[model samples]
Target: MTGTIENMIVKLTGWLSRHSIDVLRVSLGLVFVAFGTLKYFPGVSPAEALSVATLEKLSLGTVSGYAAQFVIASMEVFIGLTLVTGKLLKTGLVVMTGAMAGFFAPYVLFFTDLFPGAPTLEAQYIFKDIVLAAAAMVIGARALGARLIPAYERQAPVHEIRERVAA
Candidate 1:
């Protein structure tokens, strides 16, 4: 019974190791695409004002208003498409690094707004980016050829194992 349970656990973990990164990448891509699509419509995205404000501050007033939103939206959509399609993924990861910096900049530029005592709604929104950023990092590592290997599988040649593993 113990051996059967261990085999089941190993198989489940092996399946997760093989597919989790791609799932993370696709899910992150969907999030970006959804948020970016919201930005295309004025007053639709909850982050619209904050995003525009941050862009203005970051660009030193050179990029503002609709133009700032457009640029942000375009960049996000491009990143999303690349990640989702698994094409130009390296470029997407590169762009994602820059976009993540921009996403976190509001913490520096509008510290008061984000934390006016307790955390504001906007602060909550920005905080969620931490998970997104981490997910992107995992996806980026995979894009660069990093992989998650199950310990049992790593112990010996996979073909030598009798248990069938899901790819």
Candidate 2:
């Protein structure tokens, strides 16, 4: 019975290993991308929740703010697409982790003081992005083709494959 249970566990683990990365990449990556988009396209998400005034403090200029928002969102979408395709999951995830922090930094550093009435807003925004960053790091460390990602199982290149076959 113990052996049977162990075998079942292994099978389940393998199944998850085969599927979870794809599942997470598409869903989570798309969500982040959508968020980045909504940052600029007003009413694209929940109404008035993200105030224009709050964004003004970034001091990057009106056009710069919108550009930053759209560019970040575009990157989120691009990364999500790549992750879903599994073409560059680690690179996408690593880039996204940095990007999320980059998006959150202005609010955490400058905008927090603007909203004395909403003390927790800064904390919540910062925490959420940090969690997203952690998730991105996990994906980066585990997905295939990620040699820098130590937990992944790396196979040799095609030339090496031919040599091993000959040996």
Candidate 3:
């Protein structure tokens, strides 16, 4: 029984080892970039989607809304591109994770309570943010070298196999 469990565990580890973080990076990157684009540009579609009158009455439609959207967009794009490229992968992940956390605060506090039908909306957003942040943490670990092995790795061989020269 113990042997069987050991074998199973080994198989599981092997399977996990075979997989790379690249897939996760791609997925997360695409999501961030696309969402950022929508938030940033917001153009006609978003304007239509929003409660224009309510937004206008709140003074959110004029300046703050557009400015906030741009900031959100810029961050998203930066994070997404960095994630995809694995550029300063660890550092970027940490920074982006922080930004995402900041972005999550308002939804959890102000917006969540405003919804009559779903007073828990902000909580849900916070939960999702937590999950995303966890993912980012995982990605960041690889960059910081605390993890046993980095995800989505393209590692060099352990030793140089020099060819023997004939006399």
lDDT of 1 by residue, 66-167 (tens): 999999999999999888889999999999999999999999999998999999999899999999999998998898889898877778776855554432
**Candidate 3 TM-score, C-alpha based:** 0.60
Q: Which stretches of candidate 1 lie over 4 Å from their true place?
A: 157-167
2 or 3, which is superior by lDDT? 2
Summing lDDT over every window of 10 consecutive residues in candidate 2, give the lowest-scoring window. Answer: 146-155
* lDDT comparison, 1 vs 3, better candidate: 1
Off by over 4 Å in 3: 1-12, 43-63, 111-117, 120-126, 148-167
Query: Could you tell me how far off, in angstroms, the CA of residue 157 lies in candidate 1 after the best superposition?
Result: 5.3
Q: Which candidate leads the pack in TM-score? A: 1
TM-score of candidate 2 against the unseen true structure: 0.61
Name every residue pair that clashes in candidate 3. 21-152
For lDDT, the strongest prediction is 1
- Model 2 clash pairs? none
Considering TM-score, which of the candidate structures 2 and 3 is the better prediction for this target? 2
Encode model 3's per-residue lDDT on 11-33: one tens digit a residue. 55445654555666767777677
Between prediction 1 and prediction 2, the one with superior TM-score is 1
* Residue 13 CA displacement from its true place in model 2, Å: 2.1
